[model samples]
Target: MPKKVVYLVVLVFFLLFHPPVFADITVVINELLPTPSSGNDWVELYNPSQNDIDVSGWILDDEGTSSDMLKIPDNTIIVKQSFKLFYVSNRLNKDGDTIYLNNGTSELDKYQYISSETDVSFGRYSDGSISWNTCSPTPESANSNCEVIVDPTPTPTPDPSPSSSASQSTSTKSPTPTPKATSTTTKSPSPTSAKLSPQVLSAASESSLILASSTSASTSPIPSMEATQSALSKTKVAGLLVGSGLALIGLSIGFYFWYHRVLGNPKKEQSENKT
Candidate 1:
C-alpha cells in the first residue's frame, strides 16, 4: 500500500520481463579437409566468441537442392574459443561440391568448392578469409594452425620432338675437318717493293684512326671507389653543418621570444601601472 513499496514492485517486474542481452556467438566453417590422407571428410567449426555455443540442433549437409541435412548428435557442444571437427562420412564430390551448415531455420555458413586436390584442404583462414589456395588441409586443427603447402618440385615440361628432315640431317652429318699442316714461306720486304695502291692506303689509315678512337673511348676514366667515398663524406659533412645551423637559429628565435615575454613584459607592465 505504501508508495515506495509500489515503486519497488514495479521496478522488479520491469527487470524480470526485460530481454537478456545475448553475446554474439558466430560458428563459422573454419577449415575443410574434403580429401584427407586416411580419414573421412571432415569440416572444422571455429567459435571465435567468448560464450559457449550449443550446436545440438544444428544441421550440416551437402544438399544444395534437396533435404539431406545430417542432424548433429545430441549433447553436441562446442566450448568457447575452440575448434570442433565434424566428420561427413559420406563420399564428397571430388570435382566439386557445396557444403551448408545450418540451424533448423537459418543457415550459419555455406561453402562450395569447384575443385580440390587430394589431401589438400580448401577453407577459411584465421581471419575468416575463404580462398582456394590460401588455406591448407588442417583437419582437426584451427584454421590458423594450417600451414601453407608449397610444392618444391616444379612440373617437368615435355621435350619437343625433332622434325624428320632435321633428324635425317643429324644422322647423316659429315665429320668436322681436321686442320692440315702447311709450311709458311716468309717474303722478305725490300725498299724496291711496289707501294700499296692509294685507295687501299686510305682505307687502312681510316681503319687505324677508328681503332684508335674506339680504344681511347673504351679506356676513358671512371670515378674510383676512393673518389666516391670522398664525395659521400663531403655530402654528409655538409648535411651535418646545415642541420646544426638550423638548430642554432631555432634556439636563438625561441630565446628571443622567451626573454621578451619573461623580462620585457614585466617592466612594461610596471611602467604602465605607474603611468
Candidate 2:
C-alpha cells in the first residue's frame, strides 16, 4: 500500500469519528401577531428538534438594538418539536417590523414583513412551503387562515347634546351633599363602638394568659445556680477531711519505726557488755 493512501484513509476515519462541539438546535419564528385586538403582541417559536431544546438565555430582538430586545426566561424549554409563545415586550411595530431570534452571537432565524394587517397573523403557509403571508394567528399550533375574532364589548356611542353636559352636572351635583350628611351621622356611632372594644380587650387578656401557661408547662425545669454551688462546696470539704486524717496516721507509724531502728534497747545492750 502507498504511504499517501494510508494517510488518506486515517484522515477520513478521524473526520468521521470526531465532530466539532458547541452544537445548538435551530428554532424559527413560526407565527407572529403584531396587531392583536387588545393586548401586547406575541411571537411563536417552532423547535424542530426531536429532543426538548432549552431556549434559556436566548434573545429576540427587533432592529438588533439593546432596548428592542427581549431576553427569554431561564429554563424556558420547548418540548420535543413543539411551539412556544412569547410576549414581545419590545412593542412590535404595527406598520412594519423585523424580528430576529439569536443565541449570544449566533443568529438562529429572522422574519420580516412590511405589509401588516390588523389582528391578522403573518406566517408561512401550511403546504410545506417557505413562503410567508398574512395567515390566522395559530399561537402554539399550526398556521392557518386568520379568524375574525369579534370583540364582544360594544362600542360606546357619544351623546351629542347640550343636555348631556347638563345631565353630567346634575349627576355630579346630586352626589356631593348626600355623602357629607351621611358621613357626619356615621361618625357618631364610632364612639359607641369604642364601648364594645373593652370586651375585645378582655378576650385578648384571656388568650395571653393561656399562652403564658402553655409555654411554662412546655419548658423543662433547670437546676438553680445556688444549689450547684452548695453541692460543689460540700464535695471539696469532704475531700479535704479524708486527706488530713490519712496524713496524721502515716506520720505516727513513721515515727515508731525510726525509734526502733536508730536507738538500741537499754537492757539488751548492758547484758551483752557483761558477757
Candidate 3:
C-alpha cells in the first residue's frame, strides 16, 4: 500500500515538474533582417534539434520588451532539420537586443547582445542557472565573466537635420522649374499615333489623361518565378512544424494515460489489501 502511494506521488511529481520530451530542442537566432520600415523587422529561428519540437507558448522578446508568445497548435512542429523565420514587429537595434525562449515557468534559452554584430554570447538556462556560450568572441562578448558586453564603438545612426532648420531651408529654397529642354528630349510620343478628331480631343482633354501618369505604373510589382520558388521553400518549413506538434500532442496524451494506469493500479491494489 505504501509502495503504491509512493509510486502515485512520484508519477504526480513527474507530471508536474519534469521537462517535456522535446524540451532539449534548441532554438538559435540565426539571422536578423532589417525591413525598409523601422518597426517591420524579422528574426530567423533555427531548430538545431534532432527531433521535431513545438514552439507553442515560446516567448520572443526584443531588447527587454516582450513582443509575442508563439501559440503553436498541436501537430504544428518545427522539423528535426529546419529553419523557421519568425517575423518580429520591433526592429533589432544595433545598440542591443535580447531574445529569451521560455517553457512555462522555466527559461530555456536567453540570448543577450550588447551590439547586433558578428559574434554574440548566448546563455542556456539549466538547473535554474545561466550557462553562457563563450567560444565566439566579439567586441561585445569580450568580458568573459559577464553574460554580454557592449562594443566600445557606439552604433552608428543616420544624422537627422534639426526639424526647424530643415523646415526653414525647405521654405526658403525657390522651386526649380522642370527643365523643358530635358523633358522634351526624354518624353517620347504616345505609341497610339491615331489623330484625334476635334470633338474627341476636346473630350479627352476634359476627361482624365492616361499617358500623363508616371511610367512606374506599367511595371510589374509581383515577384518573379525565382522569387516565388524561394518563398515556396521557406513555406515548406511550416509542414515540418505541423508534424512535430502532432507528435508532441500524441506523446503528451499517451504519457498522461500510461502514468495514470500504472500509478492507479498500485493504488487499487493497496485499497484492496486494506479492505
How many pairs of residues in model 2 come into backbone collision? 1
| Candidate 3 lDDT trough over 10 residues, lowest sum | 134-143
Model 3 steric clash pairs = 75-242, 75-245, 75-246, 76-241, 76-242, 77-241, 77-242, 77-245, 78-241
lDDT of each: 0.73, 0.76, 0.57
Estimate the lDDT of model 1. 0.73
How do the residues 152-208 of candidate 3 rate in per-residue lDDT, one tens digit apiece? Answer: 788799897579878888888969779765433237554455545579988887665
Give the per-residue lDDT digits (tens) of candidate 2, residues 1-275.
Answer: 69999999999997666432233444677788888887778988886655567788888888645674688999887766678999986367877778988887788788877656777887766522366767867889877874333335888999976778898888887845445444454556666546555579899899999999999999999889999999999999999999899999999999889888667577679889999
- List of clashing residue pairs for candidate 1: none
Which RMSD values do the candidates have, in order? 23.7, 20.4, 40.9
lDDT of 2: 0.76
